[model samples]
Target: MSLTSNKSSSVLSYLESVSTSDLISDPASIGLTIRELLRRFGGASETTSLTLQDLELAFGKSIALGFSLWQHMAALDRLSAIPDWLANNAPRVANLRNGSAICGLATTHLSSPVTIHGSPSPNGYVVSGTARWVSGFNFFDNLILGFETSDAYCFALIPFPQPIIPIGSSPDSIRCDFRLLDLTALQSTSTGELTLENFPVLNTQLLSRREKNARPAPRKSSLKIPELGVAKSVSKKINSALAAKQTHPLSTDFASALAQINSRITQLEAERCDDSLDLAGPCHLLIQDTLRLFALLSGSRSLAAGSEASRLTLEAMLFDVFLQSENSMRLKIEAAAR
Candidate 1:
């Protein structure tokens, strides 16, 4: 469903009032903002069920908040698919649905080749390995992680360690050592590396397990939505700046590039393209071009630490590494070479 103009305006105003620097220094603030947005707009269901256009509208205002919300929504969507898991964890589900408890995603391994293995134990399971990139560190209470065993791939919902023990001190017990990364952009995401050693997973928390070879393929549409959303936001900003300076020499070039990008977005949305790998390259290039033009158009002001252009530029660059797989990277590289 589309977000009404009044609702959009309210969201925009609230997002605008948030300090980017404050968010960077204290990433947990993003969770609070997300909770407020969920409450204002129809709670968890509304967030999970948001259309691409709705997401684009939100992303246009603030990428950090938008990405965080998307991640939370995605985790909820995955968890809710398992009937037994939902029935067993009703109270936790209630907290998650109402925004009282935030959930983080650690399922990148399902798509990529990262190895997080789970072994059966008497009471439940023991998971051990590294989750290369887990976002929403301080903000999330639970994490839904995907791991593989000898013959099965499993998903589990577990509580994130509170007052995590020092790395070397915890040998026998379940240990999750979180190392927050120094990110150039999306710092407010609180992305980090989690090294799990003998992590305990209770029976109640085990969501699902399927044959290793039967792991579901990633949905191309869901994979490309965020990129398209952010690209549209960049395109709109660049187009607006060009409109204001009709006499600028580069206006024609900028207009042409944005036209192609906008057309690509339209085609993908209308056709629901399945070639997300192919879509990635062009979308990334278009966003880079638009952000570059935006910076150029803004002149010296865009170089400031607090500039909108600067923030968007960095956020756009984050797509290069954020949620990227090897195949997507090759396509992006090939596209750049062209």
Candidate 2:
């Protein structure tokens, strides 16, 4: 059966009850949340006898993470892959299934794309690359990194503090430590820089690689739940502030816009479950509008430090550069020019 509004609301309500302190830590609360969430929907794996409907509900549960950005982003690394990634890689699934986080380090800034390379070796391959701004992933012991081989790009599942075996003096390889960066936003996420130098990814560890001369999948950074959360929470705050002035045209207009955005989200989600439709593109615009509305209507409260409005203001800017698409960035640049 499809998840109803009541069931979805129940899951969101559970997220609201979970405190920030409970969600971000070693053995992250997000994992616990996912584990608990799985109970209601069979589980998040294909091996577990989960029906197609059950699997859909399990994926839907992640939308609740939007309520807590800390949990949402931290959990995104592992949750986004779910049963498919997990079921395919059974060898590592034992550790991963036990609340472990598997971070994907594919996001790259226009100026600094993934510079890592993997070359063929007698045994498997030798990987050396630099993946930047890898947040939330550091908390876990496992990481799924992408590197460009001589012919194509490939993904490898590597354990943290990876070891290098001596092979007739291949030069003693040194694995580096993760350094948490103090970003303007998502500072709470423990965002860090990952520098991998001559790291070894055994053939057993290599997950999937892009085929030589094959077309790459379209890149669409879909982050609907968090955007929806921002809209829902910020709008509620605005609604409350204007409770006495409900009939005011501005308040009415804000309410109308929020409804329209919500309706759009539902329609789009019903269309597909994946990030293929440039979901972030539309959601980003709606979120930007909500942020502007909050700033304009919330008045002095928006300026206060540590306030939701202030935090969201930074977050609004975060989505653009945070795993944003080239097309979206180009559109933003064009809009600025106009």
Estimate TM-scores for all models: 0.85, 0.72
Worst 10-residue lDDT window, candidate 2 = 58-67
Write down the worst ten-residue block by lDDT for model 1: 42-51
Total clashing pairs in model 2: 1
Please write out the lDDT profile of model 1 over residues 138-227, one tens digit for every residue: 788888888888888888888875544645664676676888888867788888888887888887787878886774755434534565
* lDDT tens per residue, model 2, 220-302: 43333344555555556666766766776688777776677667756655654675555556666666776777787777878
Error of 2 at 89 (Å): 4.5
Off by over 4 Å in 1: 1-10, 44-51, 87-90, 166-171, 215-224, 273-278
Tell me the lDDT of model 2 at 239: 66
lDDT score, candidate 1:
0.72
